[model samples]
Target chain A: EAGVVQSPRYKIIEKKQPVAFWCNPISGHNTLYWYLQNLGQGPELLIRYENEEAVDDSQLPKDRFSAERLKGVDSTLKIQPAELGDSAVYLCASSPRASGGASDTQYFGPGTRLTVL
Target chain B: AQSVAQPEDQVNVAEGNPLTVKCTYSVSGNPYLFWYVQYPNRGLQFLLKYITGDNLVKGSYGFEAEFNKSQTSFHLKKPSALVSDSALYFCAVSPVYGNNRLAFGKGNQVVVIP
Candidate 1:
């Protein structure tokens, strides 16, 4: 089976511009996650989705960052009026489920490298 | 609050020698620990995990980790290092059956030299 897939491996935008990244999880996976990874740091959870519902988004910057998981298969993460601090890798991952004795190994995508000028 | 720590930023090992990468975690409940490896410009690949049973868990590409509840550590090890094993390694943990949110360490880069 194919692993997680992401589009536009790199993105460059101005500080006040908008940028978006896309992700497609593995087939039959029921959970998807969006994470931000600053250089030299680990990935941090931004949002998580179980099917089409976003179960957790506490860490997401609602002021400018928004995400959507339409059809429960593919997802899009958008950042409007990007800040220089927003320059980091945006990683997408998926798993089978998040409950009851299930394996919780997440499959990650190559990630989109976003640079804000 | 769940958190993970990797003390070393990089680990160097000669090829054919044993290697180890250290990781420690703190969580409220029982821990679900995982190890992942990432090659250059690639996504992270699952290596191993420790859920409940045995402390020693074996994983992909000769990698294994020992879960120590007392020390709160889950260090990854390999019996014999290979040049291809050089990559960035991450240790992550989530509280048992808790919110599926994972706390990850900063990651450790392993270099295997010939």
Candidate 2:
């Protein structure tokens, strides 16, 4: 089985520009997550989706960041008016189950590295 | 709020020697601990997890972690290090009863010398 897939492995944009990242989860996976990883830091949860419903998005920056999983299989994260501080890696992960049990090991995709100048 | 701590920034070990990476976590209730490895320009790969059963949990790539409730620590270990084992290792935690949000620690870079 193929692992989670993400598009545009590297992106460069100027400040105040808009940027978007896309993700495709593994087959039959019911849960998807978006995380942000700053340099020398671990990945932090930005949003989580169970099927088409976003179950957890409390950490997402609503003022500039937005995400959607319309079909529940693929997801897109958009950042409008990107700032210099927004430069980092955006990762997408998926799991087979939604119960969040120990068996639900999340598989991650090669993240998209965004550089905002 | 759950948090994880990986004390060391980097660990160097010779091939055929034992490898260890330290991690500690803080959570409200029972914790679900996990370990992951990331290679250069690659995604994080699942190693293993500890939920309820055993204190020692074995994971992929010949790695294992010991979950200590008393110390609130889950440290990853490998019996014999290999050159290919050089990578960034991360420790994560989530509360068993709360939302399944994973809190990750700053990753530890493991360098295996040949």
lDDT of 2 by residue, B1-114 (tens): 999999999999999999999999999999999999999888899999998898999989899999999999999999999999999999999998887889999999999999
Which segments of candidate 1 are over 4 A away from where they belong?
A: A98-103
lDDT of 1 by residue, B30-113 (tens): 999999998877778899999889899999999999999999999999999999999999999998866778889999999999
The digit string of per-residue lDDT tens for model 2 on A26-116 reads 9999999999999999999999999999999999999999999999899999999899999999999999887654347889999999999
For every prediction, compared with the true complex, DockQ reads 0.67, 0.71
Candidate that would win on DockQ: 2
Q: After superposition, how far is residue B80 of candidate 2 from its true place, in Å?
A: 0.6
DockQ for candidate 2, please give it. Answer: 0.71
Q: Judged by lDDT, which candidate is best?
A: 2
- Model 1: lDDT of residue B75: 95
Query: Looking at candidate 1, what is the lDDT of residue A56?
Result: 91
